[model samples]
Target: MDGDRRIAAEIIEAVGGKENIVSAAHCATRLRIMVKDKEQIDQSKVEHIEKVKGAFFNSGQYQVILGTGTVNKIYEEVIKLGVESSSKGEQTKEAAKSGSVFQRAIRSFGDVFVPIIPALVATGLFMGVRGLVMQEKILSLFGITPDHVPDNFILFTQVLTDTAFIFLPALVAWSTFRVFGGSPIIGLVLGLMLVSPSLPNAWEVAGGQAEVIKFFGFIPVVGYQGSVLPAFIAGIVGAKLEQQIRKRVPDTFDLIVTPFLTLLVMIFLALFIIGPIFHSVEEVMLHATVAVLEWPFGISGFIIGFLNQMIVITGVHHVFNLLEIQLLEKFGNNPYNAIVTCSVAAQGGAALAVGLKTKSKKLKALALPSSLSALLGITEPAIFGVNLRYFKPFVMGLIGGGVGGFFASIFGLKGTGMAITVIPGTLLYLNGQIVLYLLVNLIAIAVAFILTWLFGFHDKMLKNQE
Candidate 1:
């Protein structure tokens, strides 16, 4: 109790006292303070305070990472010290002030995709479990024959594994609409219209099993199944169109008129314009991604592995989502995840090394749990709360990720999924490649831990804080 107040007092003093604070709020792991002037905050002193894991300026706020439980307690102290508190919505606007335009756009892409990840991750796990249990060799080891398994059970597995992907467009569109401030339900319906049983299945049309519906002499139309870019485009257009329609329609007719015009226009654009144009573009992107990853001697993998964490720092990592989705769309498997898993695992290792080596009990507490989170495939806490706070460990992590990625490509490691990486991601490799997957992650974690322990970190780094 006393410790929280002392830390809170020091933090308030370090950031130029309560007079300079405009508003303050605490999230799960950090204290976000919007200040009147950035020059007043002491970066060094703020970081040097015990219980303060790290600090950085973001958006329009000075953010201090104080871990989870400690942050909530420290926040009470901060409020008690007479600092005004702000709502998360207001904090978001203030946060909007920090990142570059490019950074903001990239993060917007991330936001749209973030909500849809769980569905994809769950489906991937289901796919892996089915693959694991259905393998002939594995069944033999268990003294069970494939013939003994019920046929209906196989159909049930398909229901679990395929439903999410079959309706992927709806998920993508719904999320995108929400991100862009449109009615998510309308976006979902529009997306469903694109894949309506009325339209010819794209795969069947390609396989010559179904006929292509042409609107004019040149445009051929087919149902968008297992698609992404088209739905994303449709979502953006539909949302903006809906907003415009709402503005023009009078209040009396607004509710009915707005959605009717929006859907009517968007359905045509989704099928006629966005679908054909972006689908071709998606094909080109898919091919280009395959070519680069297949580049000689795994050079591309090494480069991506090394730069992945750097991209995260720039707040632009979400750009890779398209590529990942493209890989899954074309191949039914994603090799990119192999490279990403290495990158993410190395971050965990670097944080783990810091936790093991740092002498400060407070620093140790933050690093260890952050490391665990990173290992389980979430890197933000580890990166911001520990590794990046110490410069050399971050660089070492990147090196580790690069080396691991190189090996991943050399050994042809791939995953039967997207959106999940590192530990939870093991489900993707359960089919027949779990061994290789473990090896890739081991190399990543081991290299990072070794490098950071030997050269990247030391107890002296926290001696001042202690």
Candidate 2:
């Protein structure tokens, strides 16, 4: 406990003391802090702090990398020290107001999907496990024929794997509602209605197995299974509508009337208006993404891979969630995940070079763990803490990422799931493509490491530190 307090004190002092801080929050592994004065931050001092892995200014926040579990502890201690804590939604809203149009759109997409990624990631892992267990080689090793597998076991896995994607709209809507300050339960119910059993399944309609329902003899509607945009749009409308209704409804009956009217009006709008229009828009976006990936000579892959980490730096990488989800829904696989993994690996590689070349023990300590963390598929530590601090290393990483993405595109490598990458990404390729995936990552890491080692860092900084 004393150690925690001390570390917390160091963080507070490094970020320019308590008065400079507006709000602080924590994600899976970062302590995201929004401070009033960015210039007051001591980047070098923060990075050298004990228990601090890396730190960077992203979007509108000064994000400190404290790694998983440790971040939560430090977050609590910081709060105890009189630094006000803000909800993630509030932080996002503050950050969202300042970016360019495209950037703001990307940030909005991130806001909607960030809260829902845990469910998707859990589902993806479950799918990977199911794939591994169902593989012929695994079955043979277990001396079990395909027909001999237990029926209940298969059913259980199916239930676990399919629940998230099957009802993804509800998850999106629930999250969007919360982000927009609406009642999450109402948002969830509205989302559930979009994919209700009463409506024909979306895939069935897509496959021509079931017909779309014609409402009032003209309105065409179908279940929104695996749809993201519609739920996102509907959530916004529902939240706004709920807010408006609450303003008019008397306090005595506010609870019942607010929910009833919000759902009643929003569901109709979702079914008749938002669903069909955005569904078409989603299709166009999906098709456009496919076209970009299919561009000749791997140009598309090179571009995407090179710019991937740049997007992460701006804190807009979560926008890719929509594209990946749509890709998996339409194609049953996501190549984007494969391509982006290269970018992540390259960042790790660059960080590794920095770790090895730097003479300063403090810089070495920061670089190594950040590199390892990036290799594990989370690159914030490596990016914010090491590579970006030394500008050359980051550019070297982009070059390596581009080269790796080009090769992956040429070879057409893809993963079986979305959301997991780098080391844990191996789970997605367990159905016989693991070697190809590993080779791609190796090439990416090697290229970035060599380029960074040769040209990325200057010894002058190390000399100064010494």
Candidate 3:
């Protein structure tokens, strides 16, 4: 397998050539590629390639699973092609190539970031849980106290969970430039433009608190740190520029001239023009969300809660994560985002109820652990293994989610930077008018359990599978 580069190349060629590859990136177990035309891609040929373990398509992406250690090398080779292919044939080879780089960088960053989710989630939940434990004096047995809460380990975990967001643009730029066929040094410069200290203050200027700042009394650009669209859009433009410059420059000058020109142009474009325009739009949107959430709590909570489950199912849940992070960083807290907790709880409760009601021992076994994991806010097992298998449980979970979400909305309950935890921890936001969030979560759990138990557990469909 180490000697076999042809397998990957053959698959790429079969898919329609380097040009057909609109973008290419890899995850831990899969190579995620987007191509210009589905019809031109030979699925059979891709599957038949040696060491190609599997092939499938989801969400417009062509996924090819390969053996270990092969994908990274293969991805590097693909990025080297420096050509873009598009469905309309409207985009340039550089643009097409850059598009792949941009998309794949997102995917690759996701690959790196996703593996840490469980630990990050666990740490986040533990923060809430730890607070609860201290509140209840539950840690007396371990000689723990309120002061003990801020230990080095806890501080370390806090940094770890936050590291992704704080350094996100750097990570994105590093991955993006690599995927787009540019030098990492250029990516570092691009990354700097986003995370620069000067930019955040520029937002204050944009909002009318201050005036623009100049570098060497000439350059002027707004801030874009922690902004997703700006650095990403800049990177796309930068990669294209790199491709164009690399092609025209003599081989001797290519090494020094190409990256220098790419970085110079990208920084100017990002700082002086595109970055500010895009960043301003996001700031406006943020203001809009802030104003909207100030409305009747019920409406905001209901919609957010309802859409949360749907978005996660579609694997666009990261968008929510991004939003939540942004809101917390800029505005202190987000009031309308209570569904993640309830949905996780509902999923678990529904699965547990099904487990209890099921006559099939196998289903009971499956549901038991899934429900427990779901309780811990890990719902993939529950969603895929049990709820998705038996339709009613999933529907019940959604219904419970919607109803609970509605109540949470009514209460105006919002989480204050606590990591997601079990069902009960999410109820921490309930106080007076917000108490409904707690009550509704319990009701949602009960409803999910009872309804799934009644209609789902003993269903003949699941029994037959067992």
Candidate 4:
């Protein structure tokens, strides 16, 4: 058999074969398996598989890490190996993960925002290219001048870079409706209403170029272009309303009644209630995050960097997505991403130091690839499989991250976008800001690498650790 097949076969054997598997699914970085018997699993054998970076049980599922792009392939081979997929299985998997109300809520936010990141990233790259081509210094470096740039080309770049953010409410609402089990088409329509041209534009209103229309003498209303919270809340309410309406209306009228009722009720609530309320809520949140980011002399950066990876361990880091989106929506760039990147770089650095100094070949094998993975963008393999397993290296990485984040705050670094980070994250800094970005990562990585090398690991501890 080929590598995927071989890996699938081994996973099947290790997990007590297909007969014992209740169901199996794959996410971005892991193969999640629900088994009939946990005790039957030889987890050590699963971990030793060639591409699996780590293995663990969580949320009542056995999660095997195979990194992004590989998990799906391995999952396919596993399915072909007689562990069939079932709707019940998929349902059970989702149901199993619906932990507390807070967890489900946070996970919902993650699911909604994760789909939207690629668009933002593409937009950020377009902005980077635009900034690069129009820069006097960069153009002079290429023996070209700014006057050589065409007016139409700059306009074209604006379209590429601005469309996603301008219509962000539509995207967020569409995603929220999908998550909340509403008609996504209705969600899209509702989102569009929030940004309708008939209403005063949000940016114009902010800049005092337009005024909010007061309906019923007290309700202040303006377009919700580029808004986050309003759209998100609208999606949830609209979806829930649609579901409730569908149940009450006859099937004959359901198609017309459900959507009509959802839109009619949602449009009013969204414009007058949600828009007015949550927009202010979002502003409050924005101000609070600003306070933290601007906290005296980089103190906030140091604290966030030190504690961020520790937050990752608890798996609630998705909450930051809302804050980041708010920051970008208000400020046009994200300073939070810069500080977070330093923390991530530190993790990779600590893992690299451990890989270099460890005597055991297994330690060397696991540490090196996981370190590379952390540097590229994903850090679970590095955290769970290597650094956290060693303990001290994780602490050293945290300290390094803190130190780097302090510098990031001092430098006032901001990224063009979110999602991509560390090495691939260079795209976010390409708008005449790459140098400072590089310096932050270098400082974080160097600090973590040096600290871990000097005091973090020992070969003797390997005998006691998993």
User: Candidate 1: misplaced stretches above 4 Å?
Assistant: 5-13, 16-28, 31-36, 59-61, 68-90, 97-99, 358-362, 459-466
Best by TM-score: 4
Better of 1 and 4 by TM-score: 4
Report how far off residue 418 is in candidate 3 (Å).
Answer: 8.5
Better of 2 and 3 by lDDT: 2
44-128 in candidate 2: lDDT tens per residue? 7887788787787766778888898899999999999999999876897898777578877676677778778777777767767
Model 1, 393: alpha-carbon shift in Å? 1.7
What local lDDT score does residue 330 receive in model 2, on the 0 to 100 scale? Answer: 74
Model number with the top lDDT: 2
- The residue-by-residue lDDT of candidate 4 on 1-466, one tens digit each, is 9999999999999999888898888788888888878899997788778888788776567788888889889999999988866543364436546478776666677778888988988877776677667789888887879898778977888789789878999999998998888989999999999999999999999999999999999999999988999999999989999999898999999888888889999999999999999999999988999998999899988999899999987767888988987777777788888899989999999999999999878778889988899899788888887788779999999999999899999999888788778899888888888899999999999999999999999887777754
* Candidate order (lDDT): 2, 4, 1, 3
Residue pair clashes in candidate 3: 23-100, 84-93, 84-96, 84-97, 199-223, 297-409, 298-409
Least lDDT summed over 10 consecutive residues: which range in candidate 3?
A: 85-94
- Comparison by lDDT, 1 against 3, better one: 1
Stronger candidate by lDDT (1 vs 4):
4
* Candidate 4 pairs with clashing backbones: none
lDDT, candidate 2, residue 461?
Answer: 55
Best to worst by TM-score, what's the order? 4, 2, 1, 3
The TM-score measured for candidate 3 stands at: 0.62
Model 4 has an lDDT value of: 0.87
Error of 1 at 452 (Å): 2.6
Model 4: weakest 10-residue lDDT segment is: 87-96
